[model samples]
Target: MLSWVPLLTVALLCWIFSAGQPYGLPIAVWAEDSSSLARQLVRMLDATPGLSVRAQLLSRAEAQQALQRMDVYGVVHIPPHFARDVQRGGAASVTLLHNAQLSTASSLVQRDVRQVVGTLSAGVEMQAMAKRGTPAQALQVRLEPIRTQLVALFNVSTNYEQFLAATLLPALLHILAMTAGAWSVGRELRDGTLGQWLGAPAGEAQAPARPSAAQVLAALLGKLALPLVSLWLCGMAGLVYLSQLRGWAVAGSLAWIALGLLLLIAVSLAAGALLAAGTLSLRQAMSGAGLLSAPAFAFSGVGFPLLAMSGSARTWAEAMPYTHYARLQIEQWQMGAPPAQSLPVIAVLLLATLVLLALATAALLRAWARPQDWGKR
Candidate 1:
């Protein structure tokens, strides 16, 4: 599962969101007026990338049914005499009934549809004013006295593939890393090889002899080295795929981001090792690993914003290294913060790794000295 699961999941997630943005969403339109103005707005709605006018019904009742059946995202109802209202210098209404359940799609459709209607309304008003002997420049100024430009500082395209997949890959790897670390150390105990592995040299004894704390730590590190290095390489490969092959922008120094990835891996591995050593049972250790890592992404503020969370919930999020790691990745990758700003988070991860490593080493050493605790399934 470890060898290919993360790769497959990450690839699947990327494929799911490969579309840069949501577009061509189906929307229903009902033009009660049957005027040239209503038809023009329908064409404009279809022209926008965010919406597709799937059906133009004869009556409001049919449009409502279409919306109820979910044949389309929403209905654009043009009330009767809409053109006459515009011609008579009176305000007209275009009613949009959208599916609130599909919030994101509904919002996008609403935005595009509103823009189309607003643009046409302005033009219709300007023409009416022009016919009434109003100056064109004065009409334009009166229509939009204070224009504003909305700009997105990061993830400008709002591409879900880049925004989410980039962060999701790390979370997947983190869970796997902790599981691998636990299994690496836990298996020795499960298989009854802890003594022979952590104690005296080959041919020195018939069974095995307990070694010093140094030997115990050495054995634990040596056993974990392979998996640690392998997962770290996997992390680097993911980074390369995202930033180089996929062409996702890396705002800050890639080198700093790489260091952050390394720290995240080390801390997760240490955490797993600590769990296994403390539990002294492979089954229990693996169970604990799952309970901790499985829900990590949710609490890591990847799916939800930390600022929006309750105070106690945010505190729980702060306690997880994945939270800090995620923050570091966003800071360096999306926010393009300087290396200096990233140091504190890096230090937090590094410190967590060290603390977990120390506690795991001590636990392993204790387990090494007690042969009774060696054989655990």
Candidate 2:
């Protein structure tokens, strides 16, 4: 297992950074009073790499309008007293409002906004200390960090590499495991092996018989577990390695990885069982598995902003369980959401998996009992 780690790591690395594109995070800024400090902040962001000032709104209403229309992914509004408060050695409120639909953009914009705000606030304090004839070191001591309240409704930093790398594990694992398991069901019935198992008598020394339903379900789940664990560990570790190399701070706990793994396993089993129940051919099952990637990647908002999506698109996104799971994974991993916050996300995913599993299991049992119906007359 350890020997395979390096090879797996390299594969993940290649997949993640292969895409070459600038971080095109769109942002809108509104300064209530048009203060010099606020204007400076906008200029700084425009000059900053990885960030783009898509538009500048003059009023709070304008900002809200842009957000509702999704003209921008995120908004940064500086209060009228922003400069005055800073100059007076008092704290000022700068509202950072974002469309709940664009969670990823929310985090990215907030992070960069804080960096810009911190630099500006520090400059203000340094000037005040200079007026007091304080040393440069004293100026540093007097500079207080500006607090930013971030509300991410959707992918929050748009860190393409981390997002792509982390999700690749579950996505690939599900495809491989589910496709194989689904194909196996059709193979057993087609090969007449299922009848052989049913006809075999229990030996006198044999222990109490295992429930056929339980055995089949367990076997399917067991087969998926190995790949599930491998993918989870490799993916998380790979992401951590990437973050370290890029000097990015991952905010979520390792516990979230455990939750993510369990969710992936459940999803894989459920999807596999569903495909098996349909008696899909091996090629068809594999094709179905491959089809999952397009929607999974899209609804997860890896490249696009969810806020920018229309209501119809949003409805479609909500239907995909992988979409929410991927979003939660990214939130916990890249955006620094704590375990407590991530628990609800895990709960929802578990509930969805359980529901799907129950329906799939019933369908499988019916399909198994009536294999002839699976074929066209």
Leading candidate by TM-score:
1
Candidate 1's TM-score reads 0.87
| lDDT score at residue 204, model 2, on the 0-100 scale | 22
> What TM-score does each of the candidates earn?
0.87, 0.53
Sum up the clashes in candidate 2: 7
Task: Please report, in order, the local distance difference test score of every candidate based on alpha carbons.
Answer: 0.83, 0.63
lDDT of 2: 0.63
Poorly placed runs, candidate 2 (over 4 Å): 1-160, 167-169, 195-212, 243-247, 371-377
Lowest summed lDDT window (length 10), candidate 2: 198-207
Where is the poorest 10-residue window by lDDT in model 1? 200-209
